[model samples]
Target chain A: MEVSARNALKGNVKALVIGAVNAEVTVEVAPGIEIVAVITKSSAERLGLAEGKEVYAVVKASDVMIATD
Target chain B: MEVSARNALKGNVKALVIGAVNAEVTVEVAPGIEIVAVITKSSAERLGLAEGKEVYAVVKASDVMIATD
Candidate 1:
């Protein structure tokens, strides 16, 4: 399911999406960037996870993409 | 430009591909997982980077996908 894609984004970056309460969302990004993985509130609570919790942000090289600005 | 994708891979992993001796390739992967970003040899060595070099492995959360087995 891997495909190449790109982003118009530049500079340090991170991603966050709204998540259901108690669920943790994985916010994806690289270090030096502000964010990476996030957990929804519900999932976070359910798993007893919280902010600054250590979760792995996984991606394959194939998933990495290059794009034009 | 990013999209969601999935992988069937398990356990720690790392990716390496042929590259020119001068450049460093970014092998993409997550922590706890073995491999991720890979740079071609030309890119890797050209940048004067090597293994254990700290480069951010970047990915947007939207780029990550969960799929059926």
Candidate 2:
């Protein structure tokens, strides 16, 4: 519930693609803006991830790179 | 330039806290949804990251987890 990372987006699951060991989850936080998270297949199944399911794409990384053009 | 991870958030740099070796960057992706990324100091300087700077918060993780209530 409590996390050190300050970013939290509320969105509905748009797609779920499960592979042998990893699963890609797409969460649409805003219109036309979506966040994709790659998690373990076991965790995906444990979370019961599917389209239309509401979930939080928790990203807690120490190395968030910034890019510009 | 090209990454396999799918989450790319378009946001402006809101805040930047620099430390000895790493810097914490805060990006406002939406009205109230902000994401925090911790990156290296050198990388921060290389990217020229500052407040009001436009950038993309790239999250490429092999273990992005899903959370629910």
How well is each residue in B1-69 modelled by candidate 2, as lDDT tens digits?
677656678889999999999999999877887888989999999989999998988887553557877
Task: Output the TM-score of candidate 2.
Answer: 0.90
Candidate 2 chain B worst ten-residue window by lDDT: B60-69
TM-score of each: 0.34, 0.90
> Residue A26 deviation, candidate 2, in Å?
1.0
**Model 2's chain B TM-score?**
0.92
lDDT of 2 by residue, A23-66 (tens): 88888888998888788899889888889998887777574567
Real contacts retained, model 1: 0.11
